[model samples]
Target: MGIPKWMTGKILCKTGADLVNATDPELVKFIGEIYYGLFRGGKIRQCGLGGRRSKFTIFPHMVKKLNTGLHVMIIIFLCVAIFFSLVSFGFCILNAIKVPYRAINGPAGACLWNFLAGGFVVLAVTSFMAAVKLHQLTERIANFRENIFRFVILEERFEDCFWICVASATAHAVNLLLIAISGIHFPKIKTKTEEVNVTAEDIMY
Candidate 1:
């Protein structure tokens, strides 16, 4: 019934008069600070977005901590999704190249090559999808030239790299999963066990 906490928390002005009287620089600063705070505050919660109101009993710091965790999860998931997608893409592409289309002289070889090509196409799609999700997860707030943290980091080129890496990493996870399901196993380490060897000289005398 009341305005959402995220909405209220984002308020930089209490009155219309204040907004109208504010200078351009002042307004920009206020808006920037609010965005910066929101970024630091973590992912906005469902309660903050207009669900059952957050319990009044919870302390502000606790709420902030919870939000921070939520944000971190979002980031971590996006990174993972991207990583998997790219892996899938790479496997598909590499396999597809193993048998060139022009070199395929028989139906069986051609069929296998087609299958690999199909896998490559599927993985490319997965990678593209992961990129889309990553873009949404970051809320597209990150910009290449603009520094979101302002004074902390110098140009924020990392933001651009992060987005690129995430997109590139997306679908390879499926390739790994398929390999696992196919029963292909990686080498396992063997541990040495020490057992006492009994000799005739040690016959329980």
Candidate 2:
């Protein structure tokens, strides 16, 4: 004997179509009704002629939908990222001015290089961490929205936010390496001995 086919409308799954097909008819019908209408007491759908698939839910229009509060929140995060980046860049510039000194067991140009490098390393590491965290936070927020602009672009548009972080962090790290290189200097003795000049006479041939 052949199995009977269901005559109801095509089942759509919040999870996926397979799960929808697997659900019991009564529960399926109930969920379908809830998703399709029961909550709002409406049953209206329209077929598109071509291209864009736009499904409009009517209940939302009944009330004034004034605030896209989430968009502002994402903008705030972007500002923070920009702020940190600027601050990091400032430190890079700050390190560009070298105070060359030569004293064993004391300050040297290399010490300044190392100090600047440490700052770069710290910023780069923190940038990586911030990018990762921001991407994740955006991911969770993206799922709740229907539009991309309403959530952080780090998540809403990108399927996986971790890659976004990786790219941003890589660039920042490269920039830091360049900055570290820029801050390096040849050793110079800032301690004054009124120019001690050594000639061939000082060295025995």
Candidate 3:
């Protein structure tokens, strides 16, 4: 450790032996650095209690452990929400079908099936959106590595896709229940050419 002549002091030891004999804190630190540079291949010195402790150790102030109970509660809530929403949606379709049919007087035909088909189509679209999000969440949970070819774009797309899935699932499920209870009728196309095929082949009354 060559100390500049202008900065000469007790801390700047002329030799290794002199550094070993020094008692000042700064001098000891300087001496430690010199030996560290020589023996540790130009790295910082390991000395006293300081050497034993890691520089990267986290303070208690920033630590945040995940709450297991909260996670479980959230999953349970999702299950219930999905269940009730689907049930209500089904009930709405039943009511809509039953509206036009008066026992044996009015035959359940295209009108009933059409409404059911529309409901399913809307639900299917929503499910597709949810599936997209679920796929994104799955990827994130499974893969964390970023590739050189797709470092920026893939990650960004993954985040967007994941959030969209969550939002769409929640929105569609809630919307389904709302539409079911609101006593609303969604109009369907009624084509005269699309007649009901009621062939009495098996029934023997």
lDDT for residue 192 in candidate 3, whole number 0-100? 75
The digit string of per-residue lDDT tens for model 1 on 151-191 reads 11111112333334334333333434454565556688999
Residue 82 displacement (Å), model 3: 1.1
TM-score order of candidates, top first: 2, 1, 3
Kindly report which residue pairs in candidate 2 clash with one another.
none
lDDT of 3: 0.33
lDDT of 2 by residue, 153-176 (tens): 211222233244345556665664
- The candidate with the higher TM-score, 1 or 3, is 1
lDDT of 2 at 119: 46
Give RMSD to native, each candidate. 17.3, 15.9, 22.8
- Model 2 residue runs over 4 Å out of place are 1-48, 52-70, 100-166, 170-205
TM-score of 2: 0.28
Q: For candidate 1, give the lDDT.
A: 0.35
